[model samples]
Target: MMRLIFAAMSGALFGAGLLISGMTDPARVQGWLDIFGDWDPTLGFVMAGAILPMAVAWRIAARRAVSFTGRALPTPPNPVIDRNLVTGAVLFGLGWGIAGLCPGPAMASLGFGGLPFAVFFLSMAAGMILFGLWNRR
Candidate 1:
């Protein structure tokens, strides 16, 4: 119950950050990717804003064996640039470039009640389910 509560609180905070940072705007994200044309630099600032705190969090987590909730802390991600990593990065970039909404922003955008966001979210979910099925084989 406490884990669920913490998860909900974390998610609410993340969604609120996305909203406050204007990351919920697809056009803004699309503009940020438009380097050859009129590129927006705001996303860089947002990225920096996210990365700095996360770096500090990583440092803190590295020194801790368990979270405040008494659960074991997750290990840091592997740094290897393997085929799966490359392929996933390419696919994620393609999706973000085409739709201007990656999974996080796409999920957040659903609160606005638009057909496009709904379609994207449903398709993304289907892809995730398919990938899980495929991965288990």
Candidate 2:
């Protein structure tokens, strides 16, 4: 129950941050990707905003035995740049470039009315399910 509450609070905070940062806007995201054209550097600022805090958090977590909620922390990230990682990254990038919304922003943008976002969110969910089923085989 406490874990669920914390998860909900974290998710709400993330969604609020996305909304406040204008990341929920697909056009803005797409504009950031438009390097050859009119590229927007706002995403860089946002990326830095996210990365800096996470870097600090990871350093803090490195020394901690358990999380603030008294749960065991996951192991450090895998540093290997293997084929699977590259392939997955390419696919993810292509999807993000095409749709202008990754999973986080897609989930966040659902509250705003837009057929495209709805489709993207559903498709993303379906992809996750399909990937899970495929991986189990």
Candidate 3:
């Protein structure tokens, strides 16, 4: 189907962009986050490049009924700043700063990253599962 094909292409493009932009490198991510000590600006350019396309897509989304893939656009989440959101954000930032591996980049780096990546991915998955169970209870 066209939807599946488009989804695959989009994912491929996203992975390629992450690879080409050096986003797959944990060092680069850590370096960017290290604003005080030896900061890297390449990540900024990569983020800017990504934002441009997404900005246009958002504008288009606002005007459209169904997505280009023929699915209805999903409703945006409520923009409220609650305790859980704050806690989760802080936890996410801490994990990213310590591990230098956010979800997307971590998955992308799995092959080259070897044991450390495997451990991180497994731990991340376990944490997600635990959180899901906890939230459900």
Clashes of each: 0, 0, 0
What's model 1's lDDT at 75? Answer: 79
Lowest summed lDDT window (length 10), candidate 3: 104-113
- Give lDDT tens digits, candidate 1, residues 1-137: 99999999999999988988878888999999999999999999999999999999989889999998899998778788899989999999998888888888888889894999899999999999999999999
Model 2 spans > 4 angstroms off? none
Clashing pairs in 2: none
TM-score of each: 0.94, 0.93, 0.92
TM-score of candidate 3 against the unseen true structure: 0.92
Which residue pairs clash within candidate 3?
Answer: none
Scanning candidate 1 in windows of ten residues, the lowest lDDT window is 104-113
Order of all candidates by lDDT, from best down to worst? Answer: 2, 1, 3
Q: How much does candidate 1 score in TM-score? A: 0.94
Q: Distance from true position, residue 137, model 1, in Å? A: 2.1
- Which lDDT tens digits does candidate 3 get at residues 12-128? 898788888988888888999999999999999998999999999989999999997679997986988999999999999999999888898778777777999899999999999
| Candidate order (TM-score) | 1, 2, 3
Question: Model 1 residue 21 lDDT?
Answer: 84
lDDT of 3: 0.89
Q: Between prediction 2 and prediction 3, which has the larger TM-score?
A: 2
Every candidate's lDDT: 0.90, 0.91, 0.89
For model 2, residues 24-60, the per-residue Cα lDDT tens digits are 8888899999999999999998899999988999999
